[model samples]
Target chain A: MALNLFEDKGCPLDRQRFTWKELVQPPISKLDDDAFTRVRVILMNGMEMEAIRFSHGCARMNRKWQLPLAQLRIVEQHQATMINGLLGADHSILETTIAYEQVAIEVTAAVAQNEPDEYLAQVYRFGMLEDFDHLYRYSAMLDRLEGKDANNILQCYTDIVPGRPTIVEHRAPQDNLREHYDRLRAAPITKLHALTIMSSEQQTQNFYLNVAPLYADPVVRQLYTEIASIEEQHVTQYESIIDPKETWLEKWLLHEANEVYNYYSCVQQETNPRIKAIWERCLDYELGHLQVAMNMFKQYERRDPAEILPGDLPEPIKFESQREFVRRILNQEVDLRALGTQFVNKSQEGVESQQYRQHLNASGSPTDMVAAGYEWFAGTELARDGEITREKYTRGHKITH
Target chain B: MDKTTVLGKNRSGIDISPIDIKEMMALAKVTPASSSGDEQAIAQMRQEYIAGADVLGSVPLPSTLKGMASTAMEKLMGKSPEGFIDKLGCRLAFERTGVRLYDALITKCSAAPMGAHIPLDRLHEFRNEEFQHFKLVENVIRSIGADPTAQTPSADVDGVISLGLIQVLTDPRTSVAHCLEAMLTAELADNDGWRMLIMLAEKMGMEDMARDFQQALREEDEHLVSIRQWFKEMVIKDTVGT
Candidate 1:
């Protein structure tokens, strides 16, 4: 390992704040190689913290909750400073938009890879295809509105292909729920995975909600609104997987352990020393938080921390490529959907559609507008994937106007 | 159905493997319980097996070599599990490489001197997009009841390609122009992967899947556009300075 991540001492609260000068330092190069993944590690951490910080405003915490909440705010602010310093001013909203999409892709995969249950994995896959399409739709906007190519930054690691069309992704809220895992017996990683993915998707939804109004183009704004709705459904899908039986204190403990575990991961895989230091520092801060949370759990729940957490955190999570794995799944299970705890193919009867028409009637499909915009400007309905994998998956499907 | 039978069941006894469970659930004929009075008990035991302990039961997880071997054995035995597992492995590997590439690029950009003109934020955005793709691919893999960590032949191909990109970062002499070129290679492969997937899904009668894959491919085309533009910018800047 490059460095041990479980050490206790962190930068004191007095030292966590960075000067404006430091925050404005040069952003990482577009070609530095580790820049995006490093940002992902940071962002993933941020998302989890944000989710954990707010999910437990339960009556049980009383005033004692204020302490951890204050601690969370300090650490969160420091994390924001670190990320802002890394971002600099050179990026545009379009760029941030693209990065947001990438975060969704990478983090969702990380959780899916770590998830032990097939049903939970299926819930994620349904949303994955929708976001994949969002990236493509937004790429079209980047080209049409800015007269700029989307690939300048994409660099071909992700194929900007369509997934389950955004047009059909919207569904009734009640339909989104999947069966919850048994908290007592479920893998700690699975709970952590659910929390991680839920927050990441929530962030994506919030990003679109925040930025949609900023865009001048109607289509751009509409696409954001359209996709943001799907993300809302995704949040519901992922959150429903958590066992509701666990006490808020138990959830808090898992949150802290999860934070430590993720920071440990970033420390292990980080190649850049500068970024690695940030991860290392944050890991310590999170460990402190974990210690505090552990004590609270013991006092409140009257249970050993080990009762909820595994003896040792499982191997640190890795964010590696899943190219073949995705392709294999696309071939076999592309048509599957969630029903109760089991995943069934599209042909199964419980696949409800009553609410879809009303939803579509409320607003003309933004996905249609996206396709129309592409046709009007690019003379084609679909953008090409270029030289990555062959565009062979959608061949027999109809391409409607 | 008894607690003894349930508790005594080996952790591995419930076969919830995506492939096996899917196939078993689809069977039309259930041997009408032997006319014995034990039929009700047997049926209840089966129901409990499916609903209660099946998910908790442990089974061998997916790994690259094991997935490959499982795939091969299924084919040999004429009982192929869904072939999606292998394809997802390839995508997961490629998306990770994409995320790493963007991260490296972002780090370098952030460290560049104040005087060095760079689109630092644009690079950050690109990295984010790749991360999203990474998540999407993994989600697809898990949806099919396989772990995304597994390696396969196609995934290895992606790994080898990413190895080359890492080489560019390691060598101090390689400049932004060289990195751009490496990115171009990655993008081309990504485009092909999406295109191929879309076509494959369509052919398999998965119209809904095809539409979604099409949406992703559109964004991929834009990725090619930006990468090509960035490369041109780097070349122009390099020529002027040199």
Candidate 2:
């Protein structure tokens, strides 16, 4: 059964009220080898199945319905390779640290060059910050492995960024509004660039969720859990961007295609044999992801769910409409501490709320307070505040609460 | 082998022009299209022109130049092999290879489980293009000396085309990306060939053949460009999305 986050009769707090803290927890124990293996298999298998299924679906669709199957296949193959490559990286802390650093640099450069829409830019920024945390977590894992200081391992890697041209070169300001609009629309469905932030976040979520459960050490497992939850937040942000009305299949397919395309493109340009091998492996993995998605679709085929749920659907998120997107640049600043404080406060409040108490009591209940909270907050205060603050933010300003 | 005397004197009286005879030598490398054109007359004229040229036999050229010179000499020496049979054979073989390759991929992709490999939709599209390519080649072959219906199957043709595709698909550097790069190369090569055929037809006053090849060439070029662009976009998308 699907996990629902909205309905609970026993919560003392109003049906709609909750905090972020109630939904998350820090690592309490280490992950054993069995747990790790299970999660890894599940995640990797799911991802690969999705990739293959999507590609096959596309081909079949083209053959039966006369779509551009060849072009779509090319895109699908590309995305598969990228996802596989990332997965193929050494699971060691040092390797993940380096990989994350490289991804951060690449994302930063892309943002600098294109100045993507506010949500996209925010996702990139968030992703970069998350990578730092990931670096730390992995370093901690490394410490556990080597019986040394995690901080030192982290410092060794993080220190390298300051000395390099970490940002992308600037291009001329684009006057082509239509082109930009098309880019934003097409970006999500295309290869690496997503139309919305959630798409990319899903990959992170899957990565952490899978890897977290696979660690043999408790500390490593805890760290993975923590990081995975953070990634889940990013996924939430992305999900909030999408229309809730979309069917699970549609959403899954789009995300799957996006991932496959990314890997496909990366492998194409990657000259390093190690990287290339990873890409090839990723292609197979993504194919699996597509297959999983297709199977899900097949399972759901008998049932008629709307393409998007009414509550889940929203107006397409746009950077132009997001005042925060504009504010970061105009203000030329972001208050990281302020944002952190807000998140922490909100989380603490949620944890203390009566609704959370009930949620804990009815842990296995079908009702989902978390989902409810997401809808309520996302639809009401959060949307309004995000829009309002977006106006004040400039292109390069630091984000704040 | 005096470079200055052979090339003619420069204003500075220096041997500014090198004694490279490759370019001059290549001028002789023309294959006759028909035995009916006064072969002896043309050869005599070519010889006379070579003798009259001050640089004749004055300087030896590079290996590449010598190869061209040999080709030129052969063309000058032989009568125009009457008929376009050889050209037709080359063209037919090339197009047939494209058709076969696409067909093979379609079969291969189809055999794989849905989502286990490339989508069937794309394979179908490729098959369509392959059919078109095959038709174009068939028409070319019929227009020349051979009857498309009567032409005997040659194992050599199959080997050459399949080998080329295998080379492309197996290359680690080339195969890393999606098959887009490989597809692009094939399309571009076919497009060039089509253009040449069109030109040849026009020169021969076979307006129908020229028109057909011309149209096919244009379409092929567009397909090539579009696929290439699509491949490029795919790369960018993959890079960014990850």
Candidate 3:
């Protein structure tokens, strides 16, 4: 049964509590759990992080709402900790990176298909291809540098092929923006999709920035810097799709609703019962937050949240591999480029973007350098026959005292 | 922690999701790679970078005149003393890490069922030897008028290589046998490291230092055999279910 957003006032804000033990539980096994489990963990963590970020921004803008926003932000911060803490320590930075790209590709692909507006769906397809290319580049680094297969992290669920060359994903700030959806005419689902994807990309950009310097390899450090720039562009692209004219209260109501929608999706499809419980708890907590937001909306704007949110969520975002849809998009839109508020063919792309990318790649592209001549086999590239494993170095002069 | 590996929902392999693996492999076959080539291009690029690469770092030169005299004497007698001091720094860092690894092993071993046939005293002995070895290398580097504290390039690289061993040792979830396996890797490397250091010292005309390193090499040899035997016994006991 679908959760009724209006009547089901979930665990009240006062009763929502946590202990330190609850915040830092045992992480899921990287080898044993489904890749989608990590995907949900990463995405929901992004959702909670976005919630806290939005609440803080709201409090800063409106001094009257500071106390209530402070109350909500603390809970949201703990929720982010509990969700983000589910990733086990066994994941090396590069391995966790593979899972992140999987989230971007699969979640954005799912959102693209379920989107009702053709223009918005086209926007998602464009960004998804760039993230898709990042997966291939990171996978090559994992294989060549670490001698590990990305499919171990991907679990054969997501494709490890390129979508668009990341070398060209750099775009001018003007080229990155897109037309916003009309708040009144757009379906409730359109607003939810835009927020969900924007939150996810914003979190991805932040993640890459935080972990870029943690790498010891120079090329990998460069690669993170390169891919993180694209993620920043994606955040710009997706955030622009949200109606900027929407009231702060309206945006807050949608944020709470989107959190509920995402956790509900995770709960519906989560196979691991332990992780599923966390999602259910987060969902109930998000409902409580929604209730608070709804009351504030009525007091401030004198409008019903039903005007902004559907009575129920549209549907749980599908958490499975979107291989067919992704491959088709790769075939169709690999050459598509962004102009102001629109996607264009590569030839028709804005001159500003062309100069921007050319300057970015003036020295060289780390994505190209790291992934030059890279291919994916069932095992790592080392498994391929006729490949040089150790011969190229053994013939060098032996060091003798 | 469980003292053995038990079968659970281990889903990393292709076997757990047969249907999904087939679907994935089929799609992978139909989907072409973004660019067509092999790993040779990666190597060539790496070679180019290597050609243009900066050194990891420089060996710190002696500052005091007394220290300078010591370094000059060694250089006059043999090849450059910088490589020797760098390797000594590597050994010193590894032995320091070795002490910590043994401390972790002893703590976990002492926690094992209140004297459950795991030799805590032997781990203590090893831990002390590791500390002593660290001190010996420190004194050796200082004797050569080099900074004992500065992280040499070789030491930095060795730290990178031993990171996984530290992970295995410090993790509370790893069993005694698992730690022993990690210890075995450290011991085997330590033994080889001592033997090479001894030969290097002798070639550089330091017979007294070589003799001290020979004693350390013999202790490391004992560490290797004991850890290998314990690891084998633990695995066999788990396997035979006696």
In the range B135-217, model 2's lDDT, one tens digit per residue, is 77676554333345433323244334456565554332232234555666777767776777676565555677677667667
The number of the candidate with the highest DockQ is 3
Q: Determine which window of 10 residues in candidate 3 chain B has minimal summed lDDT.
A: B64-73
Query: Worst ten-residue run, lDDT, model 2 chain A?
Result: A161-170
User: What are the candidates' individual DockQ scores?
Assistant: 0.01, 0.00, 0.37
Error of 3 at A270 (Å): 1.5
What candidate 2 gets wrong by more than 4 Å, as runs, is A1-94, A97-115, A147-192, A195-200, A243-264, A273-334, A337-401, B1-242
**Residue B6 alpha-carbon offset, candidate 2, angstroms:** 56
| Superposed Cα deviation of residue A356, candidate 2 (Å) | 8.7
lDDT digits (tens) for residues B1-242 of candidate 1: 00101123121111313343333223212212111232233234345445644221232244433544433233223323235455556776887788788777666555555413557777777777777777877775555446776676677757765876877754444556666778888889899988887766655555765786677778778777888887777676555533
Root-mean-square deviation per candidate = 25.8, 30.2, 5.6
The top-ranked prediction according to TM-score is: 3
Docking class of 3: acceptable
Alpha carbon lDDT at A328, candidate 1: 52
| Cα lDDT tens digits for candidate 1, A1-401 | 33222344344444555566654444554444443453454465455545445544543366767766566666665565665456533345666676667666666666666678877777776666666667666765665556554444443334444445566666655667788889988887888788777777777777779889976445567668888888888888877888989888888777777777777777777776777776777777676677677777888778888778765667776655444455455456556654544566666625454356455647455555444324111111123323123344444233431
